[model samples]
Target: MSTLQNFDRRRITGPDKSLPPVYDSSPSAADPLASPEPAERAHRSPSSVRPIFLQTGLIPSASGSTYLEQSSQKLVCAVYGPRQQPKAAGAGYSDRGTLTVSLKFAPFSSSRRRAPNRDAEDRQLSLRVQAALEPAVRAETFPKAGVDVFLHVLESDGLDALVCGAVLAASTALADAGVELLGLVVGCSAAWVGGRTWLDPSEQEARGARGVMGLTCLPALGTVASVWQTGELGLEEVEQMADECRRACDELHHLAVKVLLESAKKRLGRS
Candidate 1:
């Protein structure tokens, strides 16, 4: 008998052998360039956001942590640091402590497989997250220390919404860790599509939209901390979309506060 170990059983032997190409059949798999304007323009009201679910003190090892979820997106944030800063070359002590943020998407968080290492998109989002939160945090109070916020995206439905959710979760974790702040930061996103503004656009909606706007605000302080926009739009259109995003952020802030209060009450009861 021929050597069985050398047999290539996995190879196709028949002349008629063929393989079908795979394709993504999910609802969000529509072509990004396909215009959604025609269908979305007729919709009167903006897209309603799914109910938010939040909890604090979920990670015992971290100084502070919070878990937040809405629709198909889920995120967990852990706040650490406000600890001693390592001396660096040409680095001098400043009046205000530094705030560092690391935003990561889990390997399995997306429809397609993603590598674990941080990518360019992750780096950019991290910078935006830091900027959005810096204005709200009382960094000067810590002097030479540094506060590190780590965000782990368990699932992601849309990029704009993902970043916005990270900001909210990080701020909540900071508060839970007892970090002083001028006010909590809330984040929201709006998409301008087919001459209509959609609040909290789904991944499918965002891909087909003309432009998207992200806004972060300190609701209690009545301040806009950061605004990010993608695609093209006139100044007037931008301002209008921003207003819509701000309103949504304010609503989210209220819900965040309620969750924190409930968590505090539960902790007190346990004690």
Candidate 2:
């Protein structure tokens, strides 16, 4: 963690649809976070899903690599690290490893074409993704050398769920590369919509959300790394949403572990 957290919280307010408001002024009456009470979780009829799928060696130049797709989201991650340390006096580490993350939205990934330059939205998301995985990574061990994690969002169905998908993808890729982690980092997003909570919201459902929450968990440790909530909600309502997010994360972890195993089998030519 950096000293940036100690700085005065900066506020930004604009009429932008993509940017979150500096201060929530949409009135608690209509605010999703400010809902009167938590709604029951939505359930869908069980269907057959492969459990997990893995893409190996996508980044030829990287030390370790993998790509994964869960439901509607698709992500590709490459891990490069435990390598050279920057020739600086006070860099990251030398013995262990540092994780540096770069997240980008591919041009054809979105319904609209992505711009080449990193936008404010991209910067915000990259920062969040990095923060979500920090607790699971052991940075001090690397000393001056840092591990590089790259994420390419191959698609965004219009849901504000990029953080969740990216977090899981990044962690899965690291695990696939055999990076030592405190535990698996699993992430999922839930949206409060139509007086009910929806798990793994589609692009449309996300945009209609009252409050969108993204949660990351360390399943083996039985701990939560991060819980991000935007929009408005009452205390009890927020707690309920948190519970839903936890359940969703559990599902994602199952998929992630399956992917890790598949990745290993591919490397070993098991099947």
Candidate 3:
């Protein structure tokens, strides 16, 4: 046997992982990136959410595409499919189509550099996105086929907001692709900070949060698609968070509708 026969080509020579540094504001007396004081955060009310700048059909090559921005976090999603699903690997066949979501971050997306490949956080976020939008998609309409959504985080502020942004962008892209859907699914998040719930908390505000909750729903149908949360919360707190998130989802759903309508009008104008 050749001397190189046992070598695994896939392994990188050096460490292939990078992680974010623990962020602490207490030590920073003059660090410009220090977290703002409570008074400084007063600009945005507890009930208010960050302004969303969303656009659909942004990628001509994709069957559907969306670009989303909420403050410093930026995400783009491209949807392709109803294409053939791989059946050669004994993956078996399913009458219902599959919705596969992949969320990855740019190497420089966060303050700390990220790995080139999808990390655990990225995979988890992708799963959250897939779960949120799968219920809304009429997968049974296209049997033996699959729809794939790829989300890229060009930049990220808070982990909680990033997940919601990815879900929101993916859902819009699916709608833009003209996939049959029960209704548009919108995503929103809230963080329990300083003994209060704050909608759309930034990275700084969320770092010290007592809890974080992410919600996605079909607001028009008054149905929730997915709810993700972390940290200890009482039953009452959970309910309160859910109610707040749904209200925010309703607001976001209206925005999704407006974007889709405008995109359709533009397409018509072009044709």
Candidate 4:
């Protein structure tokens, strides 16, 4: 059996990497890649090479909320509002809505303990997450109010893939909040494996994997929203990666739509 000590953090994040194992068992830190395990795994066969968990309605205070956990990697998202303007006086509030995203990783959320607040990595994730979400939201409808979306990463089995999950979590939270969306935004990723692209590669896989890309899209419009890639790949390979990413978004959108509708009904009953 490989003990926890056998996996070196540096090696995992090193320039040359390999496949990170994927699991769909517990929602906790057992594998660390799966945070809150996706409830739909039973529908997917054990043999499916690409495994992911899709979940929603996990946050209460936000206009809406959603949680996605794959293996031990986990993200909890909350959509706070079309609420009052922030502290910036005479701040440029557009006819479109303003979105402010915050990303935080709990100290115990990773294999190595992290600090309590936003570190450099957290700040970067917030920026990337915002970029991924902005295109799909129709901000003009909310006027001066800003929608505050929070992403709390409880665990990160594969650091790179977890960021992709954060993008998905934020988009779902936005739809759940009912913030006037142009279309649902969905995110997915592909990692370089051997001579081919690994769709949704795990952390370990990421270490050995050469290049990775995180893609976000507007499913209804059939348009690309954001494309983020790290490392290297050929132009033709990149196009193929985008195509695969769009497919992932389409599948994820179905679950997002179902969750948002169910959440809206619950909110109506409570109100």
Instruction: Assess each prediction's global lDDT (C-alpha) against the native.
Output: 0.85, 0.70, 0.84, 0.73
User: In model 4, what is the error at residue 193, expressed in angstroms?
Assistant: 1.1
What are the runs in model 1 whose C-alpha is more than 4 Å off? Answer: 1-35, 41-47
TM-score of 2: 0.75
Count of backbone clashes for each model? 0, 18, 0, 24
Candidate 4 per-residue lDDT, tens place, 77-160, comes to: 888988986568766645766899998998778766686653678888888889878887888888877899888888887665
lDDT of 3 by residue, 192-254 (tens): 765677888778777666788888899889999988888877778878888998998888988
- Candidate 4: minimum summed lDDT over ten consecutive residues — where? 38-47
User: TM-score of the candidate numbered 4?
Assistant: 0.76
Q: How far is 24's C-alpha from truth in model 4 (Å)?
A: 17
Give me the displacement of residue 241 in model 1, in angstroms: 1.2
lDDT of 4: 0.73
Work out the TM-score per prediction. 0.85, 0.75, 0.85, 0.76
True-structure RMSD for candidate 1:
6.2
lDDT of 1: 0.85
lDDT of 2 by residue, 1-271 (tens): 4766665554333344676436446445453345433343324411112234556677878777777775666878888876775676665434656677888888767766676574556777888888889999877766666778888888776444667777877887777666778988877777676566666665555555777777788887889998888786667777777787787677778777877787678778995
After TM-score superposition, the amount by which residue 26's alpha carbon in candidate 4 deviates from its true location, in angstroms, is 22
